[model samples]
Target: MTTPNQVFEHHELLYVNSNNQPVYEDAMPGVPGIDVQPLFLDPHNGVWVLKVWFHPGVILPRHFHTGAVHMFTISGHWEYVEYPNDPQTDGCYLYEPGGSIHQFMTPETNTKPTETLMVVHGANINFDDDGNYVGILDASEIMVMLDNLIQERGLEPANYITPPQPDHNTKVRNLK
Candidate 1:
């Protein structure tokens, strides 16, 4: 069973965009200060929901996430970067995707502001070895690419792919 209601459980059909009015607005990328928006894509439990917004030395550059990415900071203090070959330290610390590194950061100040509301079940993204498809980060090399993407994907019952707090909120009010 794929789980999300057993892989969407057939199709009696509900409603995709029946005036939900948003196929995708800020589909995440204009860059200036960083704001990702892809409100929903459930299509019967495939799962897509995203809403990340950052501003404050924004460096969500070194990308990664083809699938299974989940996060939730929702208010300030989300530096969360990685990549410590250790050069006097300072990359990022609380990113928490299997322990850190699927690249996304925001925290400038509206009182130390940064927000992350995520649920990514896509897959096959591993950008940034400086090949430069789109790895243009500054803040400590985006924390060594967020500590090399959480030490190249760490997991051992330690929130395997960042799963510690669920149900902080869930309101998904009909997204298109």
Candidate 2:
């Protein structure tokens, strides 16, 4: 009669408090004034959850997702080139299907920066105007990039920012 939620006293739950996560400034290269906080990252599975902050007037290059992407806007406003009819403002939720191509930007009219929580399942492939391949970005690639940046700055990489290590000691608990 043990359920997935049942755990022994020695087991620690997989929980990450929003306040406990460290925020990194200028996380995306070539994109100044953008901040990122890793909410969850599974390098092995190529999935990730991140809290991204976009300064007003920031515009990202056109890109397409290999897998679906879910985003929840916490503050400010933003829009996509492809989804011009649906702009995501504060308290808005957006789900972009795989292979959807668009340019993301925080409207210049926005007085405040935009903050969003995003769960991405696959790589974001950048493309040129002529549809030429440029680059790919995924959870694994982002982790490696961040790690390298930390190393170059002489700062220790926070391993916990990545996926939580599997606990081998977990055992099914039966409460009858």
Candidate 3:
């Protein structure tokens, strides 16, 4: 409905100053000894970004990824139980392809918690040590859980960003 000369409005950039976001300790149900700070959520594309701090000696459930994941270690150390010799330490970047399965754990010997920033696409299908399916976690689920936890605990609201929804007025411009 616009002429060739018409100028379209540009979408504003979204930002999350993670320092303003509250870290929820043991926020994820059934996952203890970890603190989470959601930085962004894209429910439409099943993507979520988080900054997680894992206390020493904590072991996360084994999980399979439905989509790829990128994790960058910020501090301390952690490793998959299956790969004890390949520890992920400060500044380490790890990428997991879709369908990759692993159990995450922080060694009991660590004096401090391990922190990492993770960008996850799609859901994680979790399983117990016996290989029994436990649960699934995705962007929508995390969004809901964080919201609830913030309200229940009277904590500061998380500073996370979500894309603006497309509607009839949405326009796409091809810029070469």
Could you say which candidate leads in TM-score?
Answer: 3
Model 2's alpha-carbon lDDT is 0.82
User: Which rank order by TM-score, best down to worst?
Assistant: 3, 2, 1
Q: For this target, which candidate reaches the highest lDDT against the unseen true structure? A: 3
Alpha carbon lDDT at 131, candidate 2: 84
Minimal lDDT window, size 10, model 3: 164-173
Worst 10 residues of 2 by lDDT: 156-165
Off by over 4 Å in 2: 1-10, 154-161, 164-176
Candidate 2: tens digits of C-alpha lDDT, residues 2-49: 767634454556667768666777878877878888767887777888
* Candidate 1 stretches greater than 4 Å from native: 1-55, 62-73, 76-107, 124-131, 134-176
Each candidate structure's TM-score, on Cα atoms with residue i matched to residue i, is 0.25, 0.81, 0.87
- Residue-wise C-alpha lDDT for candidate 3, range 1-176, written one tens digit per residue: 87576464757777888877788999887768899998889988999999999999999899999999999999999999999999999999999999999999999999998999999999999999899999899999998898888889898887788875655756576777
Candidate 1: TM-score? 0.25
In candidate 1, how many Å is residue 106 off?
3.0
